[model samples]
Target: MRTLVVYESMFGNTAAVAAAIARALGSTDAVRLELADDRPAIGDAELVIVGSPTHGFALPSRLSRRAARAQGADASATARAGVREWLGGLAAVRADSAPFAATFDVRQAPGAVGAPSHRVRRRLDGLGFRTIGEPASFRVGPTAGPLLDGELDRAAAWAEGLRGLAR
Candidate 1:
């Protein structure tokens, strides 16, 4: 099955998670990992997996926020446009009834940090992708991450499960 893994990373933690997922998918010939800016075409792939590191308030990174802002004149417009764009992207893909999976890599912080995965999963569902499971988070250190032990393995297993769903 052709699979595409698209992700955004603030540091390298999210990138590491993306790479591990791609590796677990096994063989580069079958799975491709691309940065979100690369704008990869997933039209031929059987599965498309998207990931992002949870940032402020469990939202996407500042870059994404900036893009959202540029697309709109105000915070409300930014929110609407961001949601629309995200949904539209999913819709374009889902028009073909293709399956998709998503995960969020977030720092484990105390108290009520926003869970970006909730928003991501909702958007994916809105696009008509059958959600096979919940999103996963990987811990980050003060600088970035070597990742908390076992996080990479957990991410791999998640990717493996996603692969199974695609098949």
Candidate 2:
């Protein structure tokens, strides 16, 4: 199955996780990994996975969106939109089809204040997508991490589990 993995990465941690998940699904040829900044078309994909970094009790909080825009001010149009904006627009663009969806987020180790993936999952559900399973979270060693050891492998395993749903 073709899969689309879209992610927002402030410091590349989430991007790495997204890459690992895509790799887990299959070769790069089978998976399309995109940064939220890319505004990738979700067309013709059997599975769609979205991910972002947890911020201020939510996924891509307003403050983070501002920060991302500010940091990427000179970047592409989509880069300034961030995951929140991409997701806000997703329902409309994907209205024609419902794909198996999943979400992931990078956060402080267990006991963090929020799980961005949960919020993403809720939004995806509200948009009428059939969620494959519980949203997943990968831990970061620090705010700008180097994911906590083994998180990539864990992410890959999570992606592998999605195979049952993808099929």
Candidate 3:
């Protein structure tokens, strides 16, 4: 199946998780990994997985992106548009059989103040994608994180589970 994995990152933790997910789902061939701010094309995606660093208890706004970049955009790239803006600009497409979708978020902690996945899931649903399961989250130990140990493995495992659902 063709999977589209889109992500927005500040310190690159979220991008790392997105990459792990795509790798688990066969990144080299089937998965198309992209940065969300680039407004990645959702074309021909059997499964669409999106993720970002939860900011201010919701999706990142332009202000938040700017703030994050100030802290450190990391090597991958800072999100200029953010997932919120990208989703907002995206045209809703209703397929004959709604395609599967999932969302994940990176946060300060599991029960931290932010959770962007739910809102992202809702937006994707609005765009006519069938949700695969509950949104997922990966935790970071600090604000600028080298993601907590094992998070990458966890992300890969989560993607493997999603792959089963896609089948």
lDDT of 2 by residue, 36-135 (tens): 7678878888788999887776877557766755655223432455688888777533555678889998887686457888888888888877788778
Residue clash pairs of candidate 1: none
- Weakest 10 consecutive residues, lDDT, candidate 1? 76-85
Better by lDDT, candidate 3 or 2: 3
> Of the candidates shown, which would achieve the greatest lDDT relative to the real structure?
3
RMSD of every prediction: 6.6, 3.4, 1.9
Compose the digit string of candidate 3's lDDT tens values, residues 1-167.
88999888888889899989988999434999998778888889889999989888998888887788777766357766778888888887777856789999999867734588988898888888888877988989878898889999999989888877875
- Candidate 2 has its poorest 10 consecutive residues by lDDT at 72-81
lDDT of each: 0.64, 0.79, 0.85
In model 2, state the lDDT of residue 15. Answer: 82
Estimate the lDDT of model 1: 0.64
- TM-score versus the correct structure, for each prediction: 0.74, 0.84, 0.92
For residues 94-159, could you state the per-residue lDDT of candidate 1 as single tens digits?
Answer: 555656666565565633356666677777776666665667666766534557788889888888
